[model samples]
Target: MSDEQQVGIVLVSHSGPVAESVVELARGLAAGGVTAPVAPAGGLPNGGLGTSAELIGRAAASVDRGAGVAVLVDLGSAVLTVKSMLADGDELPENTRLVDAPFVEGAVAAVVTASAGGDLAAVEAAASEAYGYRKT
Candidate 1:
């Protein structure tokens, strides 16, 4: 599926490297092939180890494709930053959703679903399922 029809993905983390690594891993793990836009929003602009609202906002805007955006956050403050943006109702693009799931797992699931041309709801569901994932 073309990127235009696939939901965009944003990975937010307190560490910049962690966010970027998750994006790379998710794209690599997508079975259907990743055609959707995925970007990493992490850390402060000065390379500190904390979430930044400005960076998160920019990343969401960067990957927006009119198909909606699935944002997966890696830490507590990261979630808060995203929530603030959502509450504002204007910091991000239209149809942007802050997915509540494990950072790495959710990001991979979201990308896989989006790669298969899944809509926002489907992608969110797939990612949410990761919340119950277990290894035994």
Candidate 2:
């Protein structure tokens, strides 16, 4: 990764506040504060409850700084929205990876890993591992 940028992350949720809060919380979890860009694409563009492909696509592209991005989403439709957006024509950076994991947990993991200078694959792996987390 370039010294100018580490891997970035995009958080997608149905509620704008939910996604924004996750980003805030994840930034705090970073060892020395978040070094990578983290963008939240949540809720409808009108501020209603929903997700928008255009917003998500913009968020992902905004965070990407040549190191690629890891997108963590909440709910099934958020995934579908992003997928459809990507398929529709908004081409993301080649290194972008859509990670399937628990939203809050995955966002925190991904942000921390990215802050630590991990590459796109490393960040995605960190997020994906959250799927197996147990609080027992």
Candidate 3:
């Protein structure tokens, strides 16, 4: 993909089986013409904490190009897990980014921002800002 094209959004959550929910949300965004990939963290029952981060990192690496990536998580545990994975020197691509996005609202905002062709930075900012809008 070109540098200007939206690459992908990674949703990191402690919620089990993140792919289904994340993909559904992505489909909603796609219906609005946003084609960015959505990668959800977390794994099945008995899976470890960092499973989601690993999955997200893999998805981010496959994006090839674009405005980079935006990562949104469900809670503090998910956030911490992602941070630890990145700090462990997993070697994510240069454009990948992690943001502290509020659970539901942040996901919605991130999806909308990304779908609108907004850059990763913009999407991250939107997700972060959404967290402060009403303080869920």
Candidate 4:
């Protein structure tokens, strides 16, 4: 269950399992350490490989807590789909943002920040900063 007081997160990807795995991985990375609401908007309603505006919208709404929603997407079409939704301005929540960050790294960062009671901007920054992560 979501905390309903922190920023929400949405993960968008071309593959259903991949997106779902990221959500599980992110939450596990938090390790019972976070209350951030994370939803996966992957593939299509029919389980095909593609992005769906409906899924994205529903995912965004699923996690909306009035704090805001930070969306992390994988690859091209996912980005395009999110961008289109944001442009429409009605398909998603009022404060939903398409975070410009790495998929897995950013999801971890975003979830942690949001669970820590960070606000919308703070969560977005944390996720965006994940792009600079170094494993070397």
Number of the candidate with higher lDDT, 3 or 4: 4
- Against the reference, the lDDT scores of all candidates come to 0.89, 0.85, 0.66, 0.91
lDDT accuracy of residue 101 in candidate 4: 93
| Per-residue lDDT over 72-128 for candidate 2, one digit per residue giving the tens place of the 0 to 100 score | 888878988777666666467667778878898899899888888888888888889
lDDT string, candidate 4, 1-136, tens digits: 2345889899999999999999999999978777889999999999999999999999999999899899999998999989988987699999889999999999999999999889889998999998787889
> Among these predicted structures, which one has the highest lDDT?
4
Q: Stretches of candidate 4 above 4 Å error?
A: 1-4
Please give the ranking of all candidate structures by TM-score, highest first, separated by commas: 4, 1, 2, 3
lDDT of 2 at 87: 69
Give the poorly placed runs of model 3, Cα more than 4 Å off.
Answer: 1-4, 44-53
Q: Is candidate 3 or candidate 4 better by TM-score?
A: 4
Across 3-118, the per-residue lDDT of candidate 3 in tens digits comes to 35775776666655664487576567547665666666566346654445456667677653656777666666666766776677655676667777676667777777777778
**Model 2, position 23: C-alpha lDDT score:** 89
Which candidate leads the pack in TM-score? 4
Between which residue pairs do clashes occur in model 1?
none
Model 1 lDDT per residue over 1-136, tens place: 3445779899999999999999999988885567888999988999999998888889989988888999999878998888988998588999999998898999999998888889999999999999897987
